[model samples]
Target: MAICTHHPTMKQSRTNGGRKKEDTRSNAIRQSSGISNHLFEALRALRYPDRARLLWVDRFCFNQDNTEIDLMFSIYSKATSVIIWLGKENPVTKTAFEVMDSLAYIICRERNGAGMKGDNISPFAMKERPSDCSLFLNGQDFFCFSFSRKGPKMYRLPRHGSLGDDAIFRFNDDRLWTEIDGILSNSYLERAWIVEEVAAAAEVNVFRGKSNMPWSVFWAAYLGRQIFAFKPHMASDPDASYGAI
Candidate 1:
């Protein structure tokens, strides 16, 4: 289970003698003392019943007395992965995850069906690249992916002509749009440190309520929603297909 350092409740402490006070050196005591009920619930939700999970919790790892912003950069960049905790689930949250899961499946499946390997896709690798891989393609143009950390790798996606309007019909749900809003409205997205935490990590996973998903899937669903919003124009063009996902 991971603990987020950005939670306001856990960060609050009283100053002493007209000066900023320092925290105690005992990491265990400090972590145990600072955990609020909300954080407790989040940690409980992330617990594994049968196995122990190795977590790089910022609250336990960072020294509050000597907290350095540079350490945040080094820690997240070097870690294997990052887990984003969005606290306990609510009624809407479950529906949101379900919708995102369904949408993500369709999005990835469409790419795979077009001859692209799903396993080769990485959100971190593709973050700065074009969201719509087909947007800049000509008939002879090669659609390629570049990776920096995971060795020098490239993927040339075959031109599958057009993906048609079949996938568009699947996303034409008001419920999906509502759920997308619900997912984005979570307070975890508002944290100041989240930007660095997400961007620097090699892999990122999101946990909300009882559901957990890869950052790639979440990003695909959001992109799918954007494509859905412009369905009218997208359905008209043969080349500008569902490849936008």
Candidate 2:
């Protein structure tokens, strides 16, 4: 697995005499396994009853040499899974994960139950989706079939005439958008390097603390919100080719 996380660092004390410390951030991760950040904490929390989880975190795994730097994209792309760390944990983030879990259940059930209309997003169809994909509110798979015996909570998805419990209709409404955006506008998403990281991954997870959501569900809802809320004049056809969306 590949972990994409925000590395928060602090300046260490000056040495007895000479020059300032170079590569403190890298040093921190190496010396402490990112104890100062959430990456190690989140990884440590990943547990399974049966076997061990192998991970390839950028901070500790990479040598920080030219060869490793050059292969950054390669490492990310080749990884079987990608875990995105948003931040620590909070009540608002918990609710977000609940909503995300519900969405995943709704989408999966909708796809399984003989056919629904809007945005036929079938995440259970793992043949089409990488099984390594996942998302977290606080950072656990709320719907991992193999890991968790308890299934995901199915929330009502937004329909054309009906609204769901989610923030689908709130994109245009700055007031409602802020509620969700406030929690999501953390350090991770604001980075300039995350574009390639997110786009290249066949499977990805959005994590906060312990709550989680499937990336597919999040993406589908995101597109739905964008098409409907951002531009009223744009085509909202369910069957229309959104191209990658």
Candidate 3:
């Protein structure tokens, strides 16, 4: 699968432009052959235990030239999966994933067709969910997921209750939705190209630090919240808007 990344122009420097190539703005950002600071930060945070794992980031895969570029669609379509990088992790990252996971688990396991309708899970579901489902007993909150007839078991949560990042953990609705909105409002989600990239891929995975979650589950939780907006986010509410376990 292709790794789909969104380029955020926050704190960006002007690319080098010369008199010869005036029409192309490519040289401005393309002046340097090195990767962007944000990309470098993501790469450094990535924990690939082995020697080094190869990833197809746009900065490295394609030429930096801004003119006559026509490979974006083909690249996305050819990818088996898309890795959407939200940003560096924060305290809210972990809680956001866990709550989203909890909601995904309930809907998939209970087969609640009324809420989600026709399963948007086909494109975004995980192809290989972990074999072990560990449930922690203490007051800690966690999520356990099960797939339908054809899919793999999706999420196997950690003991600390963190999602993908090292964010603080909690299962409360007020705390949960508050953290979730923080993530959803990130600059990455605002990019125009993200829609085309996500739509073209078969599976979409979102990552931050050590935590990760399926894009379908995350999206569903966001939609679920909108559907059941009348009540508060606490567990007592049956709407499942905040994605409680």
Candidate 4:
């Protein structure tokens, strides 16, 4: 259960057998406050079906009247991990994350090897077979480590003024590019506080429904998208394809 303040009356009780009935008592204190339906949906989506989860909500935990802006940075910095809620998942989210997972996995692997420096920073590398896999963020399979468990095939990104033939073939699908656009165009990324929160976070996990990916991976994929757009090949229709984000 989430530990929150602002409510009063901390009633305590004990069972006859000498065991405390913690579940029987209300976990959070009762108070009257207007909660947005969007926030409610986020809280519901984060709940664990089999067990309780300890969550810290800024609105509930922070004393807005007395709290300083610096406190938010400190809290996020010290927290175990930051969860970035991107709202309920849909077909667009699923497709976007699938592409991101593959690209980020490639970036991770490269970082461990020769490192992402020089021209190698681009994700235009190849493997045995293309990863035609999909991750369904349904039920209890919402783990961030799932991508590391099985290696997904990586697609190529534009590099050195051109998208190589192999990369061009892989990126033939306009639908795939559309999904990538969807991720960047999400309104959640435009929040004013996100910059400080993410900058202060020790670890960041982005969530869209049950689907999740590391901030490093997501950022890398985003950078790749930017690089891909400005390639010489895309210069012909720059205005039509690339819009300022």
Candidate 5:
């Protein structure tokens, strides 16, 4: 009789484990894509040469819960420098830059005025300290995005030379501020004053579209006490071309 050797049989691995891992990876990708939609489109418009390396973009850095430590740290790190879009759709980047530059120049001049001068001041020193100012002061170069209106809108004010109490719409509107103060605290009022002073100087009105309350009420009740107003005309049209101011 011929000697027969029994061979051991090899078992096949299960497909279920690999399938589950793949499913999990797909779900993670889907979640990440969803979060990216919430990021402000204007900030995205300014092309960052090394965006992939910069951390703080909500989509890549933040977790679904938004309370994650990594996301918080990334946001804190990049909080100082921010890109404010002029509009929600088709922002005029060049125009916005020019406006900001002009405002910077104006600030420099104002700081060097006699009132701001001190014994320690130098003739060649840069006069303006925008960081010290509490208002936007950049004129009507910014657009506020309204979630309810589903669009962005520009805030406009009268010309720079226009002066006098009547030149501003809210010069006599002390009642509005009183009502606003009732709703918001004193600390909030102080902060709003700084923003308001800047807005007033620019002659621009602030608007928050798509809120339950009317623009007047919204301004007086919330934004008004804070010294901001609502201007419906600033709404942005996505189809229009963005031009330099």
Candidate 6:
């Protein structure tokens, strides 16, 4: 998978007489605009130059002020390969990539009629089965993350109540797949849920006047087990000895 990092330009705020004041509407608008520009720049850096076709980013294409446009963008996220650019060393970036990679692998294997190993099951699982079914049912739980200048952070935002065995079973019900597929395909309401679930899972605070936190801190919580990291230079350089997890 290709990796992209978002670097946002944030404005420092001041406390007024021991009381914190909310950002003015105009200031909020300016910050949003800056974030959008940063998103575009990140996309440009991450894109494969030779391949004309690349992933789509909402900040560049969607109008933040328009509800209709925002809903449309949310729908698009479910269908598209989304990369949240929450700056460097973001925990959200790490966890999101981990979840996305696992989901992608599970989905691809299942689509081709394959099964994943039991030992590889994530700690959040109750019993060992094919990862594909688990992902299809519980993938949304791993979607929430926070994005900030400090980095992207991840959270456990589950749509289907708890992560117990019974809940997992219900999520894997045949009826649910039909509904999920339909949601994945098309429909405004379903799409809204998909976006909302992902946004919630990602711990994204789209509203103005919120506390700021580092993204890396959120993702670090989920980094236990077989997760691995490597330097880009090490991967690109032929002379370098690449290590395995």
lDDT per residue, candidate 3, 1-245, as tens digits? Answer: 12543223212222222334432443344346465545544554442433443455654556536731355656666555566665566565676676566544434432342344554443333333333642222334335453322365545533344443223224234655655665554456665666776776656777765567777666655553333333344432232222110
The top-ranked prediction according to TM-score is 3
Tens digits of per-residue lDDT for model 1, 20-41: 2222332343376775545555
**Which residue pairs in candidate 5 collide?**
153-234, 154-234, 157-203, 219-224
Give lDDT per model, in order. Answer: 0.49, 0.43, 0.48, 0.48, 0.28, 0.32
Residue-wise C-alpha lDDT for candidate 2, range 18-132, written one tens digit per residue: 1143235435653664333444445544433344445556555556544656666665565555666544555445554544344454444444453755664342232221234
lDDT of each residue in 194-239, candidate 5, tens digit only = 3422222212222111112212222322322222222121323334
TM-score of 4: 0.52
As for TM-score, the candidate ahead, 1 or 5, is 1
For candidate 3, the per-residue lDDT at 155 reads 57
Write down the RMSD of all candidates, one decimal each: 13.8, 13.8, 12.9, 12.1, 21.2, 18.8
TM-score of each: 0.49, 0.46, 0.53, 0.52, 0.28, 0.26
Candidate 4 residue-wise lDDT, 128-202, digit = tens:
233453211111211233221134323332221232323432465555555466555556667666787778765
| Candidate 3 ranges with C-alpha deviation above 4 Å | 1-34, 59-69, 105-111, 115-153, 156-178, 228-245
Error of 2 at 80 (Å): 1.2
Relative to the true structure, candidate 5 reaches a TM of: 0.28
- Evaluate model 1: give its TM-score: 0.49
Candidate 6 segments whose C-alpha is farther than 4 A from its true place: 1-37, 88-245
Clashing pairs in 1: none
C-alpha lDDT of residue 229 in model 1:
38
